[model samples]
Target: MNIASRPTAATPPPNALITEAVQLIEEAGPLDDAAAMREAMARRTDLPGRIALRAQLLGQRLGLQHELARARQWAPWIGLGLVLAIVLAGLGLAGSVVGGAERRINIMAALVSLLGLHLLTLLAWLLGLLLPLRAPRLSFGWLWMTLTARVAGGRQGQAPVLMRAATRLLARARLLPWALGLVSHGIWTLSFLVVLAALLFALAFHRYTLNWETTILDPQFFLQAVQWLGRLPAVFGFATPDAGVVLAPGGMADAAGQRSWALWLTGCIVVYGLLPRMLLLLLSVAMWQWRRRGLQPALDAPCHRRLAARFEALAPRAIVDADPGAEHPPAPARPLDTGDALLAVGFELPPDVAWPPAGLPADARALRIDGSAEARRTLLDTAAQLRPRALLLACRAAASPDRGTERLLRELLAHCGDCGLWLLAEDGGAALPETGVQRWRDWLRDCGLERIAVHARLGDALAGG
Candidate 1:
């Protein structure tokens, strides 16, 4: 990535990001002071390079290189799984429309059957992106991460850090949506292609009588619908069935009428289904590529700060006499180490979600944040005083993770040694069209909550670290 020569927003490559995350983990481990000093002094490259090289050296020494390699392969594997799933789904939807080749085909039913789930999923993705939730799970990205951790057996080693680091880097770059969007649109494109192919084959071989049968509605509704839906198809050479065929109650239409209906159906799927998805796939690809190049690290993060300090301590100095009159640079500050206490806070949670968590030690303290500045200040002050071993902040699942929420989390996190985010999912709360658990995880990852213990259940969130 050549971070030194690049612009300020320079992004490390995926491998470098993984290495840097490993560096953070190593720095947080048992501090062997003399060993660290010797390692730091031996490096003479740019800070980013030195940091990356340090992780590589540590990984080999710790026998974690295999874990890193496995972690790097996860994204591509899960992505392939996503593509295969989508293709089968498209084929299944199309097959449902064509199976049991009877004489009659309901145009309305066919259209809805073919595109219902696809359109619904598309809408959900749009909402997730628009709300700026940065939904890493809106597609299969979260599943990819989870599968990676489990499959790679990352519960103990560098694999866990690798997954978290990847998510954080992608989220921090604001690339999660675009990256997932590209996968989504690409898969959808392939699915619709399958649909188009299936439809073409059915139309070529199987002849079905096309008719619209309504119970109580006026016939005019059916006539107008045909014209409205077929307008785009007509612009391309596909013909809409005439009023006689459109209003026909049974399969009374001639062969020509049947052919027009088939063409109209095929055209609608192409114009409405295939072309739009294809265009969106192109759009997603462009956006992802454009944003992919600048995945900057959170250099100001406490973990990085501590490591940078250690590295600087052994930094080479030019042979010059110390200036007695010059002011000395202050030593870097160390983050507060955790004590034995745990603090559980519910941030803007509704009345139902239990506060103080059910089970805690006698020394543990709990509070609910009411979104007031005073309430937040009290919480931070309390954290500073308590120096809790672990802090679990429970928040509403359905609520949009707005900027204010992120800011509050960032501030509270600094006061505690380790943090867990409990996304409180109430029984009746409004949710993303998909699951809310993953959506919140996506937001947390973007917040740079490394190796975050994201829990749906309050118990798990408050469990011993």
Candidate 2:
């Protein structure tokens, strides 16, 4: 199905399937037991009653994972607020140190300290992405999750696990990292804006001269760099001092020159530092939203596949033999002295196997039992009512004999005495696993059934009977 057409977390109904699934997960405690989860979903009549049960369930799971993450980090905004405060305080402190000095502030040094550090951070982030594996410590989001996990321990601690599992399930979606990058860069962008605001405020009230002093690098190089930086903002009609004025720098010659230098510095910070960060933030957000729109769980995963099968099995259908062999002709019906003599039943039969083999008496009845509570109850009730003289229970060899099978057998045996148990193996039993056959034998033996028959083919079993 096209996941993009489906409702997302951004736009959902009041009683969304995902919200319901999150409640179920919370009530489930540890989120184990796939059967119980399926049962819970099956019981919900409010859910969209449709053929896409698997897709709906998966979408709900995604929603539940998101809810868990949000709950675990209950106050993420608090962390963001703290970060903003720290940025403002740091910028304010730097501004104080710059404006407090009697000597002129080195505009080049201030720009490098502010914008260069951010550029280096951006480069580090890019390099980390290129590496196949990254340390957890390198991830700002991971650190945030870790800190929040510690605060909300135990049951709440499952958020990280859920998040990791969701990421793996939706790895092809590629939304998580982009979403995280958007937030990280957004914070940086905001920080720069706050720093710019502080710088502007300092420039307005305090009279500070702008100078450039570097021993190793020639002044010409610094002048050229400033001129280059000013060019972008100059396009927007901001003042870009001439090469002569930039090169003649010890300190600004006059108040007008100092004002012009301030404008140039402000323009450079806005153009170089703020604008690039803002663009990256917007790009990350766009990518994140695009990926989120297409996010879908891996429906082919074993757990989801089994759940889908379970849902499909709930649909009622006629009990008919799926596989019939052409090798054996129908045996002539042998009249039985007793009425309602033999009833053949197949339990969780594979699609390839036939039911009620041709060799059975013409009067013999056939039934197929699926893996459902209602089906099991119906089978038991039908057996009690019919009370066939001899019963034949057939099961596929590929199906592992579980406690549910044993329970059904016990119940059936209680209703019909002296029943014949048949294990129908695929491919004339040649491809049947020895261990699977032995396992069934062992289970039957434990149930005190001594005459269990293993048949490679339905025709052979019927002919033998």
Candidate 3:
């Protein structure tokens, strides 16, 4: 498969697009530096016009890894629905059973079977929200992601770069557990409704009495509880038994009473079990939508930052050269000593300039320092350890000498006492202004360092020295 081929004009779904992009980035290898990768992406002429550059990159990669695209699109929903159907069937059959030809359901037992675990799970979910606890692993969302990872062979091998990218995107969207919970709760509501339907079907073909018996509770307690529970269902025109009916010693065995009891049970399931879960499902859906709209890949992440810088460098921008100075005299040609290690520090060189430019001696080692504080610290530490015989500091000639530059020079001088200091001026394809060159020279002299030699390139300095 042509992994580098651009995707056709038709755009896939967003999730699919993202998945593809991640695959492409991984296929391209380590993106610690994205300059070459971006270049490769830009050269792809066949990428769809409608998709953004980021999406296009992914799609191209997806096109390459075609073998891994055989996920069962309908499996998650079908599996969940089948499980709900099984639970409903089991519960309905269990509730329909009778003993000694009495054919009566223990009201308390039936209610507990229907609502006990649901109520407990709801309470636990609520507590999870209030308390500092990790997300539940048993959630539908967790299961779905795990299943997807397994199907995609994500866990069996090293995690690809795109997988990490996808994770970051989801995290930024802030819809991990909540989105999963929504699916789970929606399934729970459906399961309860299915059970209710099954119960109604069972009632059509068979006759059963509903009764409550408790050793610890009096008849009045049961009557009051029934009245309280029946209030909501009563408003919807479902029948509720009065004091005489609740207090009856033989229980409600007549057809009308049985009908009333069935309506009351269905009402309780709808109002308590199904209704709240459905509401939670809706809430999660809304939250996921709200958060998804704000989804954007974090630009400051290292890989993304490098990609952004690369794109920025590619854009056309006018170069304003403040230095028009006569070029410094070329240093006399001399081969670099075999034992001297070359420590080269670049102070914002142009993107095109390669560090430790190709001609250095075999023994030389190089480090490139950018604007990051941490990188500067690393540079200092590395320099301390290497203690090279020569120190080559390279900076753009167009950049004005600032106090930060002064401080850096002071620190390096202090650390690498009396070493050969070469200030390599990179003109960035333009001549440096005479004033800029003198400014840097004057600054170095003020630091009590007079023997410093200036060169336009490291190769020239190495050749001269």
> Which predicted model would earn the best TM-score?
1
Q: Which regions of candidate 1 are displaced past 4 Å?
A: 1-12, 23-37, 58-65, 72-77, 101-103, 134-138, 141-145, 154-160, 213-220, 319-465
Question: Any runs in candidate 2 off by more than 4 Å, and if so which?
Answer: 1-38, 44-73, 93-97, 126-143, 154-156, 306-465
Q: Sort by lDDT, best first: what order? A: 1, 2, 3
Q: What local lDDT score does residue 412 receive in model 2, on the 0 to 100 scale?
A: 62
* Each prediction's whole-model lDDT (CA): 0.67, 0.58, 0.57
Most accurate candidate by lDDT: 1
Q: Write the per-residue lDDT of candidate 1 for residues 163-254, one digit (tens) a residue.
A: 66666777777776676677677777888888889878987898776666768988898789889999998998999988887866674778
Query: How well does candidate 3 match the true structure in TM-score terms?
Result: 0.54
Instruction: For residues 409-458, write the lDDT of model 2, one tens digit per residue.
Output: 66665555446656654421333433445555554665455444554445
RMSD of each: 16.9, 13.5, 12.2
Which prediction has more favorable lDDT, 1 or 2?
A: 1
lDDT (Cα, 0-100) at 427 in candidate 3: 25
Q: After superposition, how far is residue 63 of candidate 1 from its true place, in Å?
A: 6.2
lDDT of 2 at 106: 81
The local lDDT score (0 to 100) that residue 54 gets in candidate 3 is: 52
**Per-residue lDDT of candidate 3, residues 84-198 (tens digit):** 6647654664455332266787776777778877787777666655665655565554455555545554454322333444445555566555666775687677778777777
Question: Count of backbone clashes for each model?
Answer: 0, 1, 10
